[model samples]
Target: MGETNDVTALVAEVEEQERELVLTRFTHDDAWQLGCLLVELAVERRLAVTVDVRKGPQQVFHAALEGTTPDNDSWVQRKVRVVERFGASSFLTGLRARAKGQDFNAQHQLPLQEFAAHGGAFPVRVAGVGIVGVVTVSGLPQAEDHALVVEALRIHAAGGA
Candidate 1:
């Protein structure tokens, strides 16, 4: 919840973060590494969630942590759909719409049944290429979910475990 300008700034910041946080190479190993990092972070924080890394429609890695349910998995799908459709982070997409005094469903005429502009999913971009996948977390507050994924991506981008 922010002012219009704040939301606009958030979208810009996320876009810059995504633009800079690209992988030199993205293999199955990279996906596994990123996915595992999300799970580990969630566990350490006692968060009940589902984390998924997917290439297009193919899930590369996924885990439902303790206390998570099937509903969280559905959230992952919804959030990822926003990222896939917009080619941006779900949080950013949501913020952009909000800044325009609209939501994705109302502004874009997208179905809420099919898409969610939640803040948990981010595009997985590879250097010199465009977004090839999405990494998502669900079950926490939207900002927390988004932060967890972004932090993991940052660590991965910096070549950390």
Candidate 2:
């Protein structure tokens, strides 16, 4: 019962974040800035991670910090695929699946190799344009990865970055 309440609260929180983080517009420059902001935050915290920003199918920015490997990059790709396919944060998708007592892969029939429902990938939604891209980070625990991206997005949305 407590676990179910936790999941419910988490789902609500993530959904609120998705609703609140919508951008007015997302351009190439915006992608670059957001990506750099993610890098800066990770560096300041001494986090080992890979960050990626994409506009549709085009990747605009990517960075692999110290201690990250090619596997982190692969994780970025998989999480990005989840955000792109589901039009939501990967964390949210996974949480929703868990709330329903289902395996994300089995429920969606998406192969794990190409699509992951783990955290750290978020939709870059524009106010009038909907989801135009995704911003992803990998290397931390799934929840921490998601929180890092959310923190960056919150800063970016508030014009702090």
User: Alpha carbon lDDT of residue 106, candidate 2?
Assistant: 97
Q: Candidate 2: give the clashing pairs.
A: none
* Candidate 1 residue-wise lDDT, 37-155, digit = tens: 99888889899999999976789999999899999888899999999988999988988888888878989998887889989999998878888899999999998899899899999
| TM-scores, one per candidate | 0.95, 0.97
Q: What Cα-based lDDT does every candidate model obtain?
A: 0.89, 0.94
- Candidate that would win on TM-score: 2
- In candidate 1, how many Å is residue 98 off? 0.1
Best by lDDT: 2
lDDT (tens digit, per residue) of candidate 2 on 1-161:
88888999999999999999998888899899999999999999999999999988899999999999999999999999898888899999999999988999999998999999999999999998899999999999999999999999888888887
